[model samples]
Target: MIRQATPADLQTLAQLHSQCFAESWSAQEFARLLAIPGTFALLADTDAGFVLVRVAADEAEILSVGVRPERRQQGLGRALMAAAAERAFGHGAQTLFLEVSANNAPARTLYGALGFAEAGRRKAYYNEGGRKADALTLKARLPLGKSA
Candidate 1:
């Protein structure tokens, strides 16, 4: 189920980020975003796993989306992404963007399949434990009506 995330979901979301990303945000930070106005957080939950997105203004970014490592390649990520896109469009978004580590092939492939194209790159965008990692900025135009 994809729904607006609440403060109660922070711990689970934080744990997932720790498991999925080399560098994770602090619990306080996650909670802060949830408390901020104009910030939208969505979570998809089930026995399988969970996926999350943070949308601000007309741009939506995938804050954290993960399936237990054992459940990888089972389509949970795609489902979460579809929900994110739908929600973004519903909330007046015209475009969506995300940053992925340059070496993350699976993520790049998934975004490509979702109509996200490589729009640009940020040099040394991430600090991995210590070393620097470049980030690829991917973008996709959300379905918008003539009025948008």
Candidate 2:
């Protein structure tokens, strides 16, 4: 049951994000971002997952996405990404972009399958304690297709 999320879902979105990442974003942060033009969120039910995206000019960037650990491997992430891409395209975007931790193999695989390719990199962009991981910036054409 995927649906567009409103500010009313802020707390739930924060809770779900906390389950998927070591660092969680607060509801206040979500509220601030959502208030910005062209920023929106899509929620897959209350317990499954959600994705946040911002479109500007001809480009759209995925700010964040998360699936409950238990809900992973069940296609939730793929569905969320596909939906986000379509909506972005509908909103006059010609390109979709996202940054994923280089250490996150599963997310890289999922993004790759959705036609995203490595566009650039940010060294040591994700730091956890003393452990650091590069952020791989990925890009795909709007209305994404499966990679050949």
Candidate maximizing TM-score: 2
Q: Where does candidate 1 stray beyond 4 Å?
A: 47-49, 129-131, 144-148
Residue-by-residue lDDT tens digits, candidate 2, 90-140: 999999999999999999999988899999999999996789999999999
How many residue pairs clash in model 2?
0
lDDT scores of the candidates, listed in order: 0.72, 0.91
Distance from true position, residue 73, model 1, in Å?
Answer: 0.8
Residues 1-148 of candidate 1 have per-residue lDDT tens digits of 6666677777777777677776776678788876765565565555344555566777777666666677679787777788777877787777887889887888888888888888899999888768888999888888622222
